[model samples]
Target: MSLRNNPKKSMKLPLTTRTNQVVRRKLQQSSGPFPRQSTNKPQRRPTRIRTTNPMQLLSNPAPNDRAEEQRKLRMAQNRLSSRNKRLKRRQLSRVAKIQHTSR
Candidate 1:
C-alpha cells in the first residue's frame, strides 16, 4: 500500500527553476480574472417600478388653465385606463386557466 520506498518515485523536482518558469509562462498566457469581451462591456441591473397615484390626482382639483387641466385629465385617464386593462386581462387569463384545468 506504500510507495515511499519505491525506486521509481521522487519527491523533489530535478529542474524546479525551469518548472517554475514554465508554470509562470502558462499563467501569464491564460486570460486573467475575466474574458476580454466581458471586461469591455458592463452589465445592467434591473430598474424599479415607476409610481403614480390616480386617487391623489382625482382628489386634487385641476388648475384654472383650461389647456393644462385638459392635459392632466387626459394623462390621468390614460393611466387609469391602462391599469384597468391590465387587471381585466389578468382576470380573463385566470378564468381561462381554470377552464382549461377543469377540462
Candidate 2:
C-alpha cells in the first residue's frame, strides 16, 4: 500500500524522488546563474624595459658582483648566528627546567 494510506507510515517516510528533485532545482535556481563565470583571473607581470646604456651596463658588473658577494656572505653569517642563538635559548630553557624540577 502507498504511504498515504497509513498516516503513521506517511509521517515516517522520506520525501519521494520527484519531490527531492523539485526541491533541488528550486534551491539551485535561488542560489545563482546556470553558467557560473570564474571570479579570479590570472595576473600578468609588468614587462621590464632595458633602457640602460650598453657601455654603462658593461662597466657596472664588477661593483654589482662585489656587492652581491658581500650580501651573500652577510646572509650566511646571520643564518649561522641565528641558529646558534636559538640553540643557546633552547639549552637555557632545558637547564632551567632541570633546576626547577630538582629543587
In model 2, where do residues sit more than 4 Å from their true spots? 1-61
lDDT tens digits, residue span 19-55, model 1: 8877888879987654666688877888644335766
Residue-pair clashes per candidate, as listed?
0, 0
Residue 35 in model 1: lDDT? 66
TM-score to true structure, per model: 0.37, 0.41
lDDT of each: 0.74, 0.77
* Pairs of colliding residues, candidate 2: none
lDDT (Cα, 0-100) at 89 in candidate 1? 100
